[model samples]
Target: MAHRTRPLNLAVPALAVLLLALVLAPLAAVGWRGAGLSLGPADWSAVRFSVTQALLSSLFSTLLAIPVARALARRRFPGRGLLITLMGAPFLLPAVVAVLGLLAIFGRSGLLNSALQALSLPPISIYGLHGVVLAHIFLNLPLATRMILQGWLAIPAERIRLAQSLGFGPAETFRHLEAPMLREVLPGVALVIMVVCLTSFAVVITLGGGPKATTIELAIYQAVRFEFDLGRAAALAGVQVAVGAVAALAAWTFARPAGFGAGLDRGLPLSAPGGWRRGADSVALLAATLFLTLPLIAVFLRGLPGLADLPASVLPAASRSVLVALTSAALTTGIALTLALAAASRPRPLIEAAATLPLATSGLVLGTGLFLLIQPFTTPMTLALPITILVNCALSLPYLYRILLPETRALHADYGRLADSLSLTGWPRLRWLVLPRLARPLGFGAGVAAALSMGDLGVIALFAGESQATLPLVVAQLTGAYRMEAAASAALILVTLSFALFWACDAGGRRAAA
Candidate 1:
């Protein structure tokens, strides 16, 4: 399924040069000390701690999601679409926002604690390993559920109908039909969770009390941002990259193409269960929804009044955020599309990997790395707008790829042969055969990139000054200044903008996909 009519050209190489310039900002800043560092016992201990936590979190998140997903997939109910949308909402949130929401639900003065005090029970701590795991689960459970639900959706309905027609009992049907689908999806779920948890920074930092809960990304952050120990940060980052590369590659093996199931080949009708199975499923669904949503509700309640008194600075901050998101979205999409186009039918894993390299390191690590790399050269604040935009673009490539690759593959699959046969290659082919076909995915990716960059707090963290601050950066500043109301107001605004951007882009994509 490869197109060979046209020879490779300069798009990716040229864009890669630009991408490399931006992506390598940190490595260039920290280059002198790169070779001087080595992984020692302390680094190994941090790695051990991070790996264990990620494994436990991944296992727990995936296992817990199974029942939730199974319940959603197997049962019928009112408001199911709403439930599904809520489940998918976490994927759209910034990790910091989700962490905050989790804190509101699970922290000392949280709902759980209020319930405990009514019974006069001892208060539980919401810091350290337990809290980190809880936050990750809260954010990722829905993701795992969606992935598994996709698997459930993949089960050809005809197969299920055949079993029913053969008078197979419910238990027998599940064993023969459902079990295989779950097994096929399990590794992908685990691997994705492991990769995500490995890169945990915001959650670990917010929830981590001290050494006992330390993750490697947090270690890298402290080493650079707090301690200014470029040497230690480099060592830990290197270790993280090495370990993460292995895990990512393993996950890549299990990673199948997205959009596996269409509502074609239908047979069995999907519906809800009854009796004890129904009650148990209903209860699980209710608790999962509550745990997933209550913290956001708390944030809403806390911020409702505060929205009126939002700092005069917030509007300007918001203005800056939108401008930055626009620039970044354009840049990210341009870079992503160029790479995807240039790489349309070539062997370019290195180029692909380089474009996506930003995801391996946490934003804290990236910010610090870029800070060190760019400091001897220039103040990041001098180019704060562009630098933050680039970082967000780089960080969001994997998501962009989630859209681009599929559309590209499908376009190539359907018409590439004919186009090549007719010798309609290069821009002509791209303009007609490719772009029109991929409009939906590219637009969708752009929308996600825009929405995600809108809520970013990472690059701005390194570059923030009074003269320049995005809304999330402003929110962080408000939190640092102990203006809880202002921070809440900022968070609310940030969420709204984030949601709107995602919705618009996704809507456009859907229209295009249609």
Candidate 2:
């Protein structure tokens, strides 16, 4: 029995080593290449701007999410479930598509400016620091709302009932019951958003370029692409890595669990206060819905007309993106499953770290390091798609690992002994026990990885040549060329494909589970 398990144990550690190498090798390359380099004023400016925008974006996102989350938790209305489902969309949305949507409403020739002009008011700009922060808020606000809503939902119904029985009004209830939850939840929410925004590449690249708006991610791109300064790019990559690490560390340290004990599995409604509170909740719901959905609607409307006139480059690029997405999804799901299974047998810190350390690294930083590592060997363009797939796997692995770990652990606990006693091992054991039980999460995780890879514009931008461009890269190129209609059409196609992949995989998982 021990000999039978020996092979499995050895395989897990070998894979863990590979995963760690993939993440750490790039950092080592960056350090080796930029060992003696110092940041210039502009690089420092980028750092400052990056930190400032992330802080502002996280602050605004979390603060604004409170009312909206509270409203969703306390109020039950038509389309409420649908609205909650839609909230997940923006988080998974392709940044390039989201930018186009935002531009449709906020750009100089966009709806808001047009309306301002009609009203004899000065038009506003969406090409600066504010625009970057606005886009981050747009992307992360839903996530914060969702997290805070979970906190609200987790509160024991008995506490709310007790408050009501004691004749406690809204303020007193909030003080006694809700405030503590917020205290426990908001810090973690804010820090997660902060970490996400800290590695923002697309938002800053699209809406922010000037020194005042540049982030370290964008600066790395400029150093590599424009200045052809590998040293500067590597140095900037190190800074981005450090910032991400610090932010991740801060989140882990400060974001403690809510510590609220377990509750009975009974259904009870939260207190839905009447009068002005009802009106406020209604407004909050409406505002959040509009804020989220309007930009997407704008993208659809703008893209419809241009679909017939799309560039010839669009189809090939779309195909390439699909290929990359599918390949990345399959690879990520397989790797995550292997790691998850290993962890289930016996939890190991190294395995967990290997799965998650990528969270503290950005796509562009990985691209930069890979670019440096590959330059000495061959032209990066020749291997763009493969590198993109690899980076996508690394970037998307953590999400899949988190999704599959618990299920894998449960499967092991429930069936491990039985399988071992019956001499179940390797292929036979996986076929009968592991695959059947883990199929749902595996499917969903593959879907998430697929959607994320399809939408990713980061690494591909650094390595892709004209002939090798993916759909997101093509969209960015079209936009850069001021071909708004073409860009819109391409963006629409990208969004459709991304969502379709996600839905098919997710629905397939559900069907298989059923």
Candidate 3:
């Protein structure tokens, strides 16, 4: 057996316990407060709406992504790589920024409405269930496409060559090769998309427009903040957790490592770019391009004019956001690394579940619980920044853990015996063997955490006073106050900062790896 040092042995459960306390304490508080309350009919309405929208969003995003992924995979065009990179932007963009962008294109007096007016058609309202689903598709379609594209690209070139030699057409090729990959990939994609849509807070609240389109997450917010109904909020949070857990487990079951094979340093050729294939690919690419690019373009154009007239609160909020992001990044990276290392060494199911607990706990629930826990001791506002930092760290851990676990396991698998034989342990082992090997994932995970924390509005919305708002919450407040132009400007700044943080950290990772 490998020698276990006291510090290394103690760190695992310590970190695990810390994570459990951060997540579950708030949940327990909420449950204890609302123990006797049953869910009302309106709560049930929110539940139905939440599930229905999430299902529709996941279904449409996954279904639409297939042809788009196929087009991008088979037919290389001018700027194809750039388009692929831009597909990730929606994910990084603050949800408020994306909402602003979407509204700029789809809003009543926006470009689409103007076009409809010119064409003698009635302007359609960007509200209700369909609007919410559309927003979700906008956000998640790229995610689905990327997952599917990775799967498509993973089909070995030799297999493609075999199919070509056998005179297989597109139909035959898809039937034998692509169809199976899709079958393997789609469930995970759909389930992940569903999990995302299930949370459905920022986008749903923005586009949902009224009670008619409320999601459970949105309802939880309303119950706590608007109605001061802790019982209802607690009940709704419980529902969110229950649904989220099932979806998360299903997603985990279907999840496979996206096998993105290497060989891109050389010019590799593909087998599916002929006559009708060319035309179909062009249409798919163009449609996706127009759909994704136009909103961002609108945001840039509109926000440009508003930048000079931006409110006084924006800069302070931006600063606060940066602080929270950095703190959350450090905390998330540390905790995720610690927990991942422990899990890698031991492979305990309990540790793994604790690592993923945040996936089942929403920001609203955490915030509510934290608020309740702290309210009696001191004002929630007094500890707002600390609480936000902790909540953001907790929320980001699951993703960081995902990124770190595989790398940690690979490190252990490759170096455990070698390191043990050398009598290398503790700081020496970590510095010489683990740290250098882990720099890339650590940097990437930290980048993701920072960017996500920068954009997170949910828990902060629950805890922040007027003066304590983060950039996303500030943007929401601006929008609610009907300052659309100023809101756009703030959102653009938020989006820029989020992407910049991600790029810097990600670039640092790449440089360190190199």
Choose the strongest candidate by TM-score. 2
| Model 3 lDDT, residue 429, Cα | 82
Task: Give one digit per residue, the lDDT tens place, for model 3 in 1-514.
Answer: 2456776677777778888998999998888877778987778888999999999999999999998999988876789899899788777778888888888998976899999999999999888898888889999999999988988878777667778899988889888878887888999999999999998688877888565788888988888778978778877787788888899899989988534344334323457657988888888888998988888888888888999988999999999999999899998898888888878866787688788888887887888888778878897887888889998898898999999999999888998879888888878888887778998999889999999999998888877887888999999888777788898899889888998899888888778777
Lowest summed lDDT over 10 consecutive residues: which window, candidate 3?
260-269
What residue pairs clash in candidate 3, if any at all? none
* Pairs with backbone N, CA or C atoms under 3 Å apart (clashes), candidate 2: none
lDDT per residue as tens, model 2, 133-214? 8898889989999999998888887777888899998999899888999999999999999999999888888899987889
Residues 147-224, candidate 1, lDDT per residue (tens digit)? Answer: 988887777676767777887765776788778777678888888889888987667767773667788877776676
Candidate 3 ranges with C-alpha deviation above 4 Å: 1-4, 256-270
Rank ordering of all candidates by lDDT, starting from the highest: 2, 3, 1
Alpha-carbon lDDT of model 3: 0.85
All candidates' TM-scores? Answer: 0.86, 0.98, 0.93
Ranking by TM-score: 2, 3, 1
